[model samples]
Target chain A: MVTTVNLTALRRDIASLSERNALEAQAPRSAFGFGDRSIDKVLGKGLQRGALHEVFAAQMHDAGAATGFVIALALRSSSDQSPIVWLEEDFAAQEHGFPYAPGLNHLGLDPQRLVIVRCSSPQDVLKAASDSLGIRGTGAVIIAPWSNPKCLDLTATRKLLLTAQQTGVPAFLLRLGAIPIDNSAVTRWMIRSNASRSSGANAPGHPVFDATLIRNRQGMTGHWILQWESDNHVFRQIEPVSGAVVSTPAHRPPQTRKSATG
Target chain B: MRLTALDERAAKAGLFKTMALTDARAQFENLDIAFASPRKDAALLEKLADWCDRYTPLVALDGADGLMLDITGCVHLFGDEHQLRRDIHQRLSQHGVVVRSAITGNAAAAHAFARHSAGDVIEDSALTQKLRRLRLVSLEIEDVHLAGLKRAGLRTIGDVEVLPRAALAARFGAGLVERLDALFGYAHHPISPRCVVPACMVERRMAEPLIVMDSVERVLHALGDELFRQLQQRVEGAREVEASFFRVDGEVRRIGIQAGRPLTDTKTLFRLLKERLSTLAEPLDAGYGFDIIRLAAVRAERTQTIQKSLDSTVQETEEIGGLIDRLSIRLGTGRVLRPHPVDTHIPERAVSLEPAVHTAANPPVEWAPVQHPGEPPERPVRLFQPPEQIETTAGIPDGAPAQFVWRRVRHTIVLAEGPERIAPEWWREHAGALTRDYYRLEDNRGHRFWVFREGLYERGQTTPRWYLHGLFA
Candidate 1:
């Protein structure tokens, strides 16, 4: 049966409908690789866009792994039309001589499309992140130094999520060290070095390492290992480690507690 | 010959509102004033205009309801500026017009006086006295903010003048008192004129007013031609041109045009101006006919004095630039852009976008390491801002992906190559210190992908999660 709606009533209904439609709009989500395919599959088509994806180090010294993971993801995910915005917190580019430049280029990202904004203070980084969300055609924005607890406050996280949803751009946060695992993020996991292999008759043979996927948002965690080819600038996965190494100290760390799920 | 005796009864009766209100209207009334109420407008304005003409010839419209005059050098023409001002005011009063005239050392002071305090004429010697007598508010001072002064019993400018400025600043805001001092001329008060005064301007006063649009257009074209001739004689080319039409009904119509390359061609100038005018919603109307039409060269740029070359090739480049300029004006400035290279290792950071004309052709940055598309990169077609975390249970940790689920779908890894193991840039001090375990895993469905874990092996560590960074497809 056709319902006869009044003009004013219909207008009010339309207004509410639009409001509701906006409120109920599906939040944008994205998926980026850790340069690992098995892990990407379980991540629900990668990372969620228009949301904050966080990575924490096992310890402060292991920060290189997280950074490497982020740079690879940023380069791999970015398209020719849309670029990445890397937000730095008190990071001196000249002093480090563009640490991620070579890796990012090797990963097939155009260096010019990447706009790096150096922020001395957390306030600046947060403000810049919010502003970047409004820029059209920006694929993703990476906010590093996710360590400051204040950086990921509820207000900022919600804003980041809303911005990503609104614009369909992804945002990533890299913290200094492992934070208290909470369900603020859509997924969680831990990474560790693969068992080192004895190779090369020389001093420094090809570096062979393995990684463990300790957590997942929607699937079971497992272990993957590969060797880095310095000459080709690529990684080639090797055979699975023998059963002895599965529980050995090389791949598994001692008694790490699982992250609390939401 | 006749003796007059003062009689109290014959003297003017006590002032009444009706009797005190002058029937004579002002020359220029404020915008807020009533437009119609049995008041004479034209005759009163004519008398004022005549009186103002005696002061300067460059008088023009001011605000929505005001008049501005350029008294440069001409002030000396009328018996020392003071006498000239007094005579002008006396003439205005004789015509039953109330006027306020100010004769200052400069045009700004004169204008400020005419607008703010239109009373008695101020002489240079008694300028301070007149300024002191004027209310502080007249100098744009906030009255409610005089609390500190009230406590100190400082009532007037004269009172404040006696106290040390340093002491006064301590008691009150320094900026506030400094402004007051500047206004009073204790310090220099440099004034910037509202509009840039044209160095060379030409006006054509018609013998008879014109009402037809064709006639106005003819005058404009003629004026443009004449200005171009003058420019040619002086070896100058205008970058911007403005044509102004002043109507008898006080309506002004202005048409402005800009040139890509400075030129003084009347045909091109008219074409541009006509095109601009066509876009106007309201056409230029000479309500009561126009009395004057002026064509001015607002800005100019130098041109080479090269001999006229028969080279058609030379003209083409200039023509193209002109075309781009016109097209840009019609469309928008940022419609066309050029890509320039920047120094960065990240692929996306390689190029910057800028306006084609403004950008330098040379790349701004240089990088040694560059990867070509020919090289197989494990780069995903779509990359996430941050890698997504995933759960996995598969083969040994030291090998290719055995099996995993992404986006709620499970995939058994068949062919996978990675553990690229990109380390964190330690110097950046990123918040999420991650040790990523990156891998390129292919599912049984023939689709390959990249994924990584955010952080390295450790328990009780908060940061780091497994994330699917990007897709190969």
Candidate 2:
């Protein structure tokens, strides 16, 4: 006599699975405004707001330029009432002399709101960033680990990204090299300076940038070929590249798993 | 000596009659006056005190035509007490002050004899007979007692000392009796100084004054070492150190440094002093170079040494601090700052930056709640020093513009997500007159935008423009 499995037990197992699925569906999806439109669509609407959004700028290895860009971005995102926390590593080049404060102020950003923590080493910077995540009134935290030797490590970076994700304030890391660490970050992008024709006599030129979302969540990975108008400091899609516009694949969230070690 | 004769001449004049005359220099704008007593010719006592400093730091006015010095440990350096007193009198006479010389077993007798006799060294054998010969005025009695003694026809100190002590007290009052006894060495008469001498002080009497900064620094280092050795005698570290330069002329410049903690290390103390000296707008100039360099400890405290770790990282931090100190010294204190956290919702008020002074303490930081714990307002990535106005066509009759021009560029909105109204902070009068309706709008060209409505629709103000404050990365 062959015994058959009980119908109620199978049904109960199915019910538990369904309940778990329902709970997972109810969990709020992390979202942040890309502060751009097309990029937001590709990025699942802004960087997961309150989540860690890491962009690995491989070609943009220049820390100063990257620092300037981050400063501009942080200034753009901050308000007079709430400011961004900048944890700086050992990037003490002569050019880095206290100019960031006044420069940010000149560009329609409040200089007083920028909290610059000058640490001796990158480890200290990461520690300060991790510490900043637990602090309220801190809208965004910009960390550059590669600039300081002590902070240039795998462990601290992972810990920092984890803290950023948990707290929701975006942590922008300036990528030092070409190969992106996909697992350690939610989003990894490579920003290459693309050339554009000068529009008019006085207007310097059109800034065209080729930013590839090399790694993305939700299967939305592709390149964003855009024109960066220098005057406005904005990026607009000129035309989508062939592999640039990949839609989210149905049935599961896209996983571009990257290792903790880069 | 030359000064003793001058003092004898001044003693005949009775110039320095009272303690009041000793401090008379403080009232005068110029202290370089020849002392002249209206009562007598004893105008040389003041000059004598000024000249005596050349001999030692300790000097005081004793009586009319007289100056007293302990000279206990110092006299031996000048060969003997007689030689030291002789040298002192000679120096005084050179500067035109009359002074009398007297040495005795005690200060009171010496003071009395100095005022009355010439070169009197009263031994124990002749003490009583010598006291009887002195006048009542030399007894340092009060005015009433002197008048009483003169009325009673006992006008001499000898007459007063020969009388019974009980009868003297009964007739002339106790003050008269006591002052007589004090003057006759029957009671103690302790002398107090104007300024107490520091326990440890080192002075460099430069034969040739130092004019160069490097030389001055070298002198300072040597002086600091000497001062440190003096401090070491008492097992105390200097909390406050002062370097004083006395020019050839009458100008004195003092640079002082007070440490956060008591420090005895010469190099560290020198470095701190260097920072302070660098910040001085006017460099101290020694016209003919500093003739006298003195390092004095104004305040001292017990110092406990902490065993320093041999860790290289700790050393590096110290090095960085030193570098910052140098930079801060070069820049104005207001220009170089350390960001300190402030407890406030407003970003501008959240952190206060201050100069990197060694004594400045780390301010209290409200570290908990790493979230949007304070005011949950939307902050800009870039904050304008002054919020710039963006011209937007969003507030037209139709409301929410399909296309708005910012920085003179036309970008059409593909999808817009807010009129998230952020009213101006009502309490602040300086907040601009704009009720922002912030919208995270994407342009038709796929550029994400941060645009805000400056005013309301069909309300008080017309032409509501949108500001482009920041861009998304």
Candidate 3:
């Protein structure tokens, strides 16, 4: 009689586990695409709407490009009528600069639709970001921390992720001057600035970025060179030019190449 | 040095104010003495006035040592005028303060009665008779005017009042006559209150002091309901609301909440207040508990009632506004801000961040276009307020830099865009400012920078300086 009861309990546990997996698979998740077919295909149609995505600058100088990429993602994921909340650390503002309204407008975001919260510390940024993400009507939240702060642990990121999932508002965590660390994010990206296609007479064209998917929960990681079309508010694949000559490094000597590569 | 003030013990020991320290010490070998600070005395008086807010909203500072409470319509709340005076004196005395108080038809008479005769509630019928018995010093005239009045055989207010016509004005220069009229209750003398009298007010007096937050919140909600009911009668809404907590021991704590729009909902007001109280730097110390809680609408505005609609857009706007209010209260109002575009050519001044609670009510302004249809952005994504100076080597004086060093990194220019000349606003205060020539440059590693050279080399200025103003995405 004891053996029979144990078997029945074991069967019930397996059945419940499978049922939970099935329910998770059946849940509907709406995603917004990057407009580039290649990138979207790898992302399984598009990026998930209500998930925490981490973006890191390859180097400190690439902060501007990383910021632009996040803003473009925010604009794409949410409607124009809904406001985007930006939580920035005071150190980051002092190191990089303040987000200029005209520059944000130049990136196709209405300056009026942006609400900014300037915090003195990373902990405050996290606190305000969590509060903003819990609200239902917020379009998206952008949290920018200057460097790797001790307060930003796995637990904090997980809390932010759970709040985002519950409220259906996407959150982007932008890290400048920091390397990729342990986080509970759906996707992680490393961004570097790419040379834009110069217009006539060596004039720089639209903004371009070399975005590397370092980690993806549901798909394989990939890299791509994407150009931002501000007028259309979408990211497009860079076109290949025929017979283009590669320019040599003017500042670094050839002997340093091996060490740099290593 | 001379003594500026004295306590009861020192006064009983024959040490009056303005007496020399040596003389006082000679009179008593070991008399306790302390140097007086008029500033501290004034501060203590101000605090006492704040505590007196429990009696009436029109409490004002009467000198460096006294408080004047105008209880015109508030006398009925505490039984009667005599009962109110007794309540004030008893409460203050329990706090270990030497108390003297009076109630009269006007502030000047009340001031005189309190200083001369400790406790008196004089009626209007006896105002003239009371004024006649007061001495000339009660009028608070200058020493020179007092001596002149004494030499003229004017020892009391009645002595001066009987002779006041055109002759008194000529001798006292119209000041003493004004003081005499004010004492007789003929001239108006209003006391300037410490706080603005709220448009609508409601209060709750608990028999038992409240120490728990739950009870405090309950009392706030009840007071909010009563305040809203009064506001609804006139079709008005509050823009700012203040809650004053009078502790059992003479301590007052005031918390104020400001809304983006005129607020009429009691639930919203309570929620905002709860957020503010929870996030305060120093939590409310309900030492001994609060006996009196008062809520007042300090600022109100006319609000038109709108019909409720089924559209989700209206509900969404309201939800967003509520979120803004909560965030503003939690993180101070100045921390949460909305970007406002200012019409100017300078990049930093073009956008000003105003507090979100204020800008939410005003219509959005038009932002100047910063990008062209087919070209890159004319402005950078992030701009430094005061541009950082950089070292650069331009191929020519009028051309863009070929190489530059910024923040200890050397960047070789791979591509460059021109000389978008933005001249200073010569029509304004920057008349002597030099014209700047800006360039958008891309380095070999592909980082873009917006750098400008201040002053033209051909304009007969000294060596031109280059600055990295912003970074492009």
Candidate 4:
């Protein structure tokens, strides 16, 4: 006799199976960000430890801001004493500039725990990433290849992902000025220079960024206005429309608007 | 081509340097020949000099092919000067490296005798007799001067010794007399050693050469233990430790470790050394094998703690220090850096980077933690290395911008505060230097920025410009 399968029940069954699988593999193979529920929820319980994550910028100018965001993530992952190895391709380092330790330390990521390695090419970057992934006591391994390196493809990223999984180390891949490349990254973030909103008016206030969750393996993609709270080392989501809206040509004066004048 | 060099076999067959290659070939029809590489020979000599460190720590490369060993107080360690020379000769010969070694009270005398009277040991009292027996070539003077002397009936040093010092000085200039004085130990002649002299050193010379990392590690552990014992007896600690591995192939590999604090612990030293070796960019090549390993405490300091200072925070601090040391070693000395804020108003000159391991913010000048009670942070968490130029328009001539465009994104100012004037220090003012009016601005959105307007309207011809100096995060 032929029987009709219940698809919804089958979906439920698979979901439960995955939940049990997570529990089985729950031997300290988990990472959570900043202990903030809002970020943890967005990141699907802290970025899935022992996995590769991608942080990219929409344009070349946003590389600095993207770097800052990535650094924040690394700082969140690493303890004060544990070191974070930042591997940058030679070209990327040239374009984006070297990491300024004093500024970074001011931003609350312990400069003492950050190790910057300049690799000649993307292949060298991947090689260093793979080697650093197995280091047991480090906080995190971060790599940013040249804008679009020839060898920074899905195959290489997949290999890095597997290594991260095996060693229970978190690796962040920064794609400077490049759009998302199809890979096995658990999450992809696109950060740009968003006008920072602050609570106070006169003195400089907290830094704010409009971060878009471009890719999410386990959940839906979303956008948020997040402010990095340096003191607390946590991120707060600011209501987007409430802050200063990025002015378009429509917001400009009549004399200054070229299109309108023309 | 001329025969610039000849081996022992060719020398025995009556061939000498400066002889025509064609004549040498004609004399011995089937003679084996090869090209000469002076660079390679010099490299081999340096390696040999490094190997001689096994005899004494003060071994220096002498000229092109000789090594000067200051075995002054070290001779007794190897029984005596004659025994040390014999040991060096036998060991070098076994390695197929023909060597001539001599020991004497003076450096130049030892160098001269090593070649002319190979394997000779001349006591301080017997120096005169030895100088008399040695040929004029032993002085290592110029060939032109030596030929002049030879033509003048001075075939041996004895003939030159009998002559007045003024005569030799007049004949070959003052250099000849000065060299003779140096050779006879009448003047100072100190050989500059290839490596830095250590403060206190302990060495282990293995009976059998070791080629594996395990043996090297074991040797390092034993040396560390012994060093710590000696340091403890003196109530001192090592700040800098250098390990010299004399490979049997004549190469010397040096590894140095600097601790954040004074250290005399063997285990910690060994652990740090192991980490360093494993992470070395150039792997230690124990080609052939390493027969001698020397550990030197190049810098030492009195231990702060007589006994272990038991404190929870102190332990934590030490652990942090250890981590920094390891990371610096693995990465590089300058890779791991900490920022110490300078008391400056200029945004760019406000901080300096220092090696984190040694200059970390120890309690004294800690940058007052970023957030202050009710006051907004005067400084931004992240400052642009070079303040980025911003397009801004203001209601007042020298006031905060009412609207600013950054990276092609415009933000209308909702609230503004500042015009806090920070004039350039007269002593530090440059051509572009001008009085800056800094403003803290809040856009229609809650976003805040630390922007500045430089040069007042009448003060400079160009309109006051705006800059986004730092991000207030």
Best TM-score among the predictions, by candidate number: 3
TM-score of chain A of 3: 0.88
TM-score of chain B of each: 0.51, 0.52, 0.95, 0.82
- lDDT tens digits, residues B1-473, model 4? 78877779889999989888899889999988888889998988887877777777788888887888887788788897778878888878987988877778888888888888854888889998878888898887898999999999878888887889997899888888888898888899788898777777888888899999888888988998899888888878887899999887667898999876667798878777877888788998888899888898988878766345654445545655565566566656665455566777776776775666566325424554444432344554445656778998887776678799987888778656787788788887776788788887766544456688878888654777788876543
Docking class of 4: incorrect
How would you encode candidate 1's per-residue C-alpha lDDT over B1-473 as one tens digit per residue? 11122123323333222222232123213212233422355444543443354345456544433455666687666667677777666755665655666666444445456767765455667876666655434444456556656566756556776678787677666865676666456666444333444434566777688989899888887888888887877778777777777665445566766566666688777766766676567877788788788877877656557565796434534443343344333333343233455554233344454543232122334444444443334444334443555667647644445777765777666455666676565765476666667776654333345677655556455444566655442
Report the Cα lDDT for residue B27, model 4.
Answer: 98
Best by DockQ: 3
Top of the candidates by lDDT? 3
* Model 2, span A131-232: residue lDDT tens: 666443466777655432543456766776667656555677654433454345666655543322223321112333456667665558876655543234
Off by over 4 Å in 1: A1-262, B1-70, B73-103, B107-187, B197-200, B206-209, B229-235, B281-289, B306-311, B336-473
Interface RMSD of 4: 5.9
Chain B, candidate 3: TM?
Answer: 0.95
The collision pairs in model 4 are: A196-B447, A196-B448, A197-B446, A197-B447, A198-B446, A198-B447, A205-B472, A207-B473, A243-B445, A244-B445
Give me the runs in candidate 2 sitting further than 4 Å from their true place. A1-262, B1-69, B98-111, B114-116, B119-132, B162-166, B184-190, B205-219, B230-235, B244-255, B272-292, B310-473
DockQ of candidate 1 is: 0.03
lDDT of 4 by residue, A1-262 (tens): 9999999999999999999998757755677564567767766666666788899866655665677778777777766656677877767755554566555665677655665665666776787688778665657888888777768788888888888877677899988857676888888988765555445544345555667878888677877667676666777776544212434556665332221111
lDDT of 1 at B231: 80
Candidate 2 lDDT by residue in tens digits, B1-473? 01222234344544343435445344443433445553453444454453354446567776454577755576666787678778667755664645577877667778778877775656767877877777777776678867877888876677777789898788778877777677667788666653345556777777787888799888889988888877777778876677777765535677776554455768977877877786688978878787777777877767555467875444433433443444344433443344554554433344466554433223223333333222111332223222345655553453556677755667655445565677666686375656777665544333344466677876767566666544332
Judge candidate 4 at residue A129 and give its lDDT: 82
Q: Evaluate every candidate with DockQ and list the scores.
A: 0.03, 0.03, 0.58, 0.14
